[model samples]
Target: LIAYGWHTMVTGQNVVLYSRLHLVCSRPRVLRGILWMIIANWFISNVPTTVFVFGASSANPGPFNRPYYVWERLQLCLYFVQELIISGLYVYEVTGMLKPDFHATPPPQKERRGSVLSALGTGKRWKSRKVLRHLIYVNIFIVILDISLLIMEFIGYYEVQVLYKAFVYSTKLKLEFRILNQLTDIATSRMRSS
Candidate 1:
């Protein structure tokens, strides 16, 4: 629960920073939609977990009852869905930014391939694509782990859920730190170059 709260706070911080630094408010509706989804998901996923974890419900007998277990799994699913939406939004934004302007001189034929390795070998645009790819991969990994955890819980492996949640959330936080750092570096370099 604490991990969820921390992740939510970090996400909220990122949203605020992007809005202020990039004028995201003036961007497409998708950006605003992503912002609201992140905020709403954070609240939706955190509130029940927080209540069960630290509120009077903790004292209830067999707090991990069938309904509680189902609710928890649903929350995890919702969390991953939000992650997917955020990642997709990011990819959309990055690709849009990287799109060649028709009025500008087109790149040579050799520079037009869309392969992942080719993108990585390129310059600033490549950096943005690489970071976005990393973000997608990380989110995919987390979704897989989350599904495994949910399965374990469903199959009466409740004993490991606490430890698993701890490990997963901490690892996710570290990944988020790396992602944020890379994004900041990319933005700073872009600003300087411009």
Candidate 2:
């Protein structure tokens, strides 16, 4: 039951992560690759972990113990890498967003430059960059949380590690609201500008 619960929670977190990534990134290839990665990891990690977890608790657990011991670490490592890849995509796309030179619109020749456009654009860009920076900070903090959980697991703190994992993912989900509003604002501004 715990395994089932954990699986459902972590899987939802990955889905949320992918949805957020889809917002800022437009390339179909990148998005598809990430979706496939999520599905693949879901099968590759969760199935075996579930099997090993149940088996290890059975009455005659000798055979399953060694496998479970190795599998627990492998599963966590897989999740860590999966998250890093998703976060890496965000950082890449966000970095490109911060570079607005190519996307900048030319000022009208008839009118004075940057009167209304410059003021609005400058303020929006500043806020956007600040939001992007916060996004990066959130990612870093998440990575740090994952690292701490990984360390606890490796050091044989299985009991605490499981509870900590739930906390970390919940915290990550909470932070997404900050990015959500900022992203919506950016999209609305872009639409209006166009």
Candidate 3:
């Protein structure tokens, strides 16, 4: 199904990001937490939808046929909360990396930003910060779309909800791919320059 494909794409990107973060980030625990959250969210949100979509064709409908409106709402709520946590973890990691070491002595007046290390460090940090900002914006947009979908579903808009869900997931997958591409490009350029 479309949702399954989207889930797989998102999961693949997240796995790649997780590995990259493990290499570059100071906090492994945070990265692990984010990975776990992503796995959990995928299972909680996507698995049931997949089952329902596939199982609907069977002659004897399983328990999935039961209307679990409350379950759907709960899943959405958990998805939103986990996304907030994941985004917060990303921001935390980026900010932590960007924090200058206060214990180190200041650079000499003559050897300040002119040094290659300083220049590259500042440039990389700026790029990372820009990426972080983009991530935050993307997360906000996703949250907004999720809320809209939830509201529509609650209002008994089942007719359009299915189409909306597919569209939103596809759009989200595309945005995620864009972010991952930009990140990899940044990393590759930095590596080549270094």
RMSD of each: 6.5, 2.8, 4.6
lDDT for each residue of candidate 1 in 1-194, tens digit (9 for 90 to 100): 45466456546544543443243123666666666776787677766666655543466646545556666677767765666555555556554654532124435667667755444336655566677678668767866876776677667676687677667666766666676677678767766756
Write the candidate numbers in order of decreasing lDDT: 2, 3, 1
Score residue 5 of candidate 1 by CA lDDT.
60
Candidate 2 residues 1-194, lDDT tens each? Answer: 87898799889888988998898899999999999999999999999989988988899889999999898898889989999999898888877866783456656665436488666766776777788789889889989998998999899998898888889878977876677677778877778878
Better of 2 and 3 by TM-score: 2
Candidate 1 structure, TM-score to reference = 0.63
Scored by lDDT, model 1 comes in at 0.60
**Could you give the candidate ranking by TM-score, starting with the highest?**
2, 1, 3
lDDT of 1 at 69: 61
lDDT of 3 by residue, 132-186 (tens): 6786688679778878878877787866976786676677667766666766766
Cα displacement (angstroms), candidate 2, residue 20, comes to 1.2
User: What residue runs in model 1 are displaced by over 4 Å at the alpha carbon?
Assistant: 1-28, 50-64, 100-122, 125-129
Off by over 4 Å in 2: 101-116
Question: Which predicted model would earn the best TM-score?
Answer: 2
